[model samples]
Target: MIRFDNVSVTYGDAAAPAISGVDLTVPEGELVLLVGPSGVGKSTLLGAVSGLVPHFTGGTLRGRVTVGGRDTRTHKPRELADLVGTVGQDPLAHFVTDTVEDELAYGMESLGLAPEVMRRRVEDTLDLLGLAELRDRPIATLSGGQQQRVAIGSVLTPHPRVLVLDEPTSALDPAAAEEVLAVLQRLVHDLGTTVLMAEHRLERVVQYADQVVLLPGPGVAPVVGEPAEVMAASPVYPPVVGLGRLAGWDPLPLSVRDARRRAPGIRERLAGLSPTRTGPEEGDRGADRASVPDGSSGTDRSSATDRPSGRRTFMPLRGASGGRERGSAQAELPEHLAVTTRLGVRRGRAEALRGVGITVGAGETVALMGRNGAGKSTLLSAFVGMVEPASGSVLVGGLTPHRTSPRELVRQVGLVPQEPRDLLYADTVAAECAAADADAGAEPGSCRALVGELLPGVRDATHPRDLSEGQRLALALAVVLTGRPPLLLLDEPTRGLDYAAKARLVVVLQGLARKGHGIVLATHDVELAAELAHRVVILADGEIVADGPTADVVVSSPAFAPQVAKILAPQPWLTVSEVREALR
Candidate 1:
């Protein structure tokens, strides 16, 4: 139902096309996954299908793009609204109504559908996406993941023939992501709907795609093939595929189930070899308290300790001062960079966090995980002083966060929020970095250097708005790091990054941790937690449900386990790198 003939898209006065030499035919009722590294024009290609390219986006589109045999070149986005549904990377930007129910019905209303049909479709969509409980919630009050589901439900309510989605599950938890993907599967199989999706979290969606379209790089010809064939040699892939490649499995497995079917031999080969844990020892604070079997002993119980009945409350940090003497302050800083005791936060008649207690030590990385609206982001906000606690206390570098001045807070903590663009206002990347350095009183090249290390190939002259979602996230992270705070907080840090960029990020964060920086990231990327985090903290309904060693917390929970852990189950392995290192 969708065709791209010799397609090439280029923005104004660029050195080359953002994407070029693209040609493919997507049959009706099939789901096509667009795979590539960040900033490779996957979004551009998806835009072309929905008639946003060269029309609403003000880009030059070469060749032809047709949907349902209707030429996209001649049809504007509004004209094709009935036939096409497009959800961009940012869900907040897609909303046209205030409440969940309104947003879902707005699309159908725009299409001039009958009142009865719109009401039925809206209810069906709310149930399909698990948004029934949030039907009356305002769009602005919902969590990022909730907003994503609402955006998708809005599109689905219109009953369009084609669905073009960019990172549909980026903000969702594993179970919610599965629910949304399952709905897509039903639409494709039961209703003959066409879906073209671009996502960075390949681990979540690769197994569900009907076909894979691989975009190698900017201006490079596209490669189209079966999911397994394309992923075998594709530069970017999920952890399960990487594990399959490492084990020399034929026709590399796309899902954990497939890998498990072939894992018996590898399991025996890895016997007596323990997975590597390079971070703090188990004796450190926040370590699993239960007498779980260590990997070295060849016992693979994979069970982490349950939540402690009596949570530990830390004393406030000491010697924290707002002064110009950076060296003196660094020496006086306590081991606990951040501490929260029975923290409670309320937002708009809802308790966002309840009785939450956590701690972050110097040179340690902790991952905050949970389902959508699970209070993960709210906890991050509490740390950064974005939200005031309704009860209990929060201390960062020995000082209360909400009571501290903005200038002093920058010296103690920094946060990269879920929406990276919120921290960037400069026109160009160079200007943003310069401003960051100036604000933090750092060396001239400080922020620029971090950007170079975290995200290579980002031009200094590139506009922040023009960059892809992943690139924008990296730039925002670099800006936050410019201040060189003792504690760093990241919300959905890997939202748009591919495997390669994410690896670079892991390396950079690891280096920071080695240098005594405390990092707390709120994310749904279990692979990232497995690869980089020393501790895992799970939240549920505004409360801490699980907090322990990374392996223990994730391996035991089927919903949050990484692909590598799921495949290598009955073994304590968490990542392909850990397995490779153990074998070596």
Candidate 2:
């Protein structure tokens, strides 16, 4: 259905082509998974199939590309809209209508379909994607994951022969991601549709793909093969593949079931050891932090001016074993890093949050997780002063967040939002870093240094828009970290990051925690929560349903557990790193 003959794409007067010397064919009615590191032209390759590379993106095309035998060069995106359905990374950009129902119907309307056909497809799509409950909600008011589903539902309703998706499940929770992937699988199996998807979260979609196309790097020829063959040596892989490689499994497992079938021997090997935790234990407000190497800085040197006066510092309370005493008497509580008492937030007629209360101490990491529209993002917004509570209070460093001045609040707290582009407006990366330094009162090149660490090889002359999604997210994180805030809030921090980039981020965040910074991140990446969070907080229907230690909370829940935890059930292991530590 899709063919690339000697394809190469170069934008403007670049030193090297974004993708080069690629000759590939994707059979009809098959799902092809595109795997690669960030900025390796995976998006560019997908764009070629949709005719957006040279036509809409204003790039030079060196070779012919065709979809359903229709030459993409001759057929612009609008010309091929009937045959191809493309959903880009940013869903808000893809939206054309205000409400979910309207957005889903708009595509079929553009195609000039019959009214009855459009109505039927719209209803089927809403039910298929579990968007029936949100059909009347405005697109702008929905959460990030909800917007993503709406964008997908809009495309699915059109029922095009070919589907091209970029990071389709990046914003979704685990269950929602599974539902979306299952829908795609059904499309391939039952409807004979061709799907070409590029995603960074390989853990979610790898097992469903029939063929794997790997762009090894920029200017490198593509490698096409079976999923296991490609994943064995792929630079970026999920935790299952990592575990398979670590344990010398002959054929790498792609899913938890396969991994578990091969895990008995290794489980026996690790029977003598316990999985290692990366942060303070749960229910211990003053526990000694687990030692983690400093990947970002040397020590906690936050400015006293950024903190409120006359607040007591919380000391690390420990027992004789350097661990928190399980049943010891609790000490008088000191001023917390953040506190929310009976918090309530309303969006339109919906209660986004209600009767919510949580606290964060110095040097703690917490993860907020839930299904789409479950109020995780709203709670993060409350911490960053983006939304004012309708009832109760939100305090950071002892001052109310909604009442605090923007200038002072930035120093006390910082947020990297789900849409990283919202925090960027500068023309070049260097300009953005310079402006961040000035705004945060940091040393010259402070933001640039952080950018280099998070996303290396990003040039000063490159526009922020030119960077890949993961690179843009890293740049936004650097801008926020430049402020050296005591409290950090991240909404879907790993939306576009691959395994290696995420590990680098984990190390950097660990370093920040060691420096007495408190972090709260809202994410659906269960692997991230397992690796970085001391505690996990689950939200459902705008209220906290469960909150406890990371292992205790995620290991028992089938939907929220990571691949490692699921593979080695009854062992309480949550990550490949923990398993590796125990094995060693």
Candidate 3:
């Protein structure tokens, strides 16, 4: 249905082409997953399908891209609206209406469909995406994940033959992501629709893909093959694939069921060895004393101000017989850094958060997880004073966040919001770094250096808007970290990040935690939480339902468990690293 013949795209002022010599074909009624590292032209490749490339993006097209035998060069995006439905990474940018129902119907109206037909399609889409309850809510009042679903429903309502999605499930929780993927499966199997999706969270979508397209990097030809073949050598992959490779399986398992069928052999090899559990050291109470600005032990402080200043030291724990330890108390305890009491937040008539209470500790990484519209983003907003609490109080270092001034807040806390573009306004990356340096009062080139650490080889002259979703996120994170705030908050930090980029993020965040930085991130990436988070907090209907150590929280909830945890049931292992260590 979609064909790229010797395709190459180069934007103005770019030294290299975004994509080059990409000759590929996606058969009709099949789901093709586009995979690659950050900024490797996955988005650019998707844009070519919907006629967004070299059209609305202002780039030069060297070769032809066709959808349904219709050349994109001859058909602009508007002309191909009925044939192709494209949803970008930022859903808010795609909406033209105020309410969920209106947004879903907007595309059908544009296509000049009958009113009755449009209404029925809108209702079907709302039910298919589980957006029926949110149909009357205004787009502005909805959460990031809700907005993403609305954007997808809006496109789906049009009933286009081809659907192009960029990070379609990035903002969705595990359950919601499953719903979206199931809907896509139905479209491919029952309706004969073609889906070309580019996503960074391979763990969520790899098994569902009919085929895989791996773009190694810029200027490198893409490799298209079976999912297993591509992931074996692909720079980015899911944990299950990593486990299969480690176990020397003949064919790498794509799903948990397949992995479990082969798990008996591996389980026997490490029969009595217990999984290693790592966390904050016990009896190291003074480890974070320097993080308290006033040297007070009480939780009266509003925010933390001590920046992360040291490296992390890892120590392995063993039993008396020199075997790995399990169910240790030190691995589950948290050193408190900030606490909230009966927090309540209201946005207009909506109770975004109600009696939400949680604590974050220095050197601890806590993941806030829930379904869409569950107040994860709202809670994060309250921590940074972007949203004021209506009833309860929040105490960071010793002060209330809403009462703190912007100048002081930058030193106390840093937030990488859901919309990375909201933190960027400068034209070029160099300018953005300079502005961040001035705002944070950091040394010259400090922000730029941080950006390099997160995203290497990106040109200083590149426009911030021109960068990929993951690159933009990295730049925003660097801009926020320039202040070296003791508390760091991230909302969907891995929205567009590939495995390589996410690995780098894990290392950076771990380093910051070792240096006494308290990290609270609201995310839908379960693999990330399993690998990095020390604790997990699950929110639902604007209230906290569960909070505990990572292994306990995730393993108890089937929807939130990682691939490894699910495959190795009856075992306490949460990650591939844990399994590998146990085997060793």
* Every model's TM-score: 0.92, 0.91, 0.90
Best by TM-score: 1
Model 1, clash count?
A: 0
Candidate scoring better on lDDT of 2 and 3: 2
Local distance difference test, candidate 2:
0.82
For every model in order, what is the number of clashing pairs?
Answer: 0, 0, 9
Local distance difference test values of all predictions, in order:
0.84, 0.82, 0.81
Over 146-259, each residue of candidate 1 has an lDDT whose tens digit, in order, gives 999999999999999999999999999999999999999999999999999999999999999989999999999899989999999999999889888888999899998999
The total number of steric clashes, by the backbone 3 Å criterion, in model 3 comes to 9
Give RMSD (Å) of candidate 2 vs. truth: 7.8
Ranking by TM-score: 1, 2, 3
Candidate 3 lDDT for residue 219: 82
Better of 1 and 2 by TM-score: 1
Q: How do the residues 510-539 of candidate 2 rate in per-residue lDDT, one tens digit apiece?
A: 766765678999999999999999889999
How do these models rank on lDDT, best leading?
1, 2, 3
Q: Could you tell me how far off, in angstroms, the CA of residue 394 lies in candidate 1 after the best superposition?
A: 0.8
